[model samples]
Target: MGEALRTIAFKVKTASCGGTQCVNSFGDEQLAVDMLANNLLFEALKHSHFCKYACSEEIPELQDMGGP
Candidate 1:
């Protein structure tokens, strides 16, 4: 197939270091863990359908669903 797709794997760290006890170096206060999971789930599926490569914390394995 001529279409091209790619996957980006992001490392996620869960810790008590947030807000007053937050230890995140970046100091991001955008999305919460639960919301992040929900959003990631939908985002992953939305992109995975035709992605040549798919990966995420929601998925345990790399998926090849399309032509490179």
Candidate 2:
């Protein structure tokens, strides 16, 4: 999580976190950085082989990660 956040911070400093991508489930504007962070964390959890499910403000649906 820390590493992922660090990556986001770097992106922010680099101006790589672009403008809004879309509106989230809460009707809030979702920025590119938000998507990036969400994807980063999701990928990390997916590769861990222990996270069975996940949900977030960006993707409110419960996702099956194929973990055991």
Best by TM-score: 2
TM-score of each: 0.30, 0.80
Clash pairs for candidate 1: 17-22, 17-23, 18-21, 18-22
Predicted candidate 1, C-alpha RMSD: 10.7
Ten consecutive residues with minimal summed lDDT in candidate 1? 2-11
Cα lDDT tens digits, model 2, 33-68, are 888888988987887889899999999999987788
Clash tally, candidates in order: 4, 0
Model 1: per-residue Cα lDDT over 1-68, one tens digit each? 11211211231354332534222334434334533553455466555565566554434367564535
Query: Cα deviation in Å at residue 8, candidate 2?
Result: 2.2
Q: List the residue pairs that clash in candidate 2.
A: none
lDDT for model 2 comes to 0.85
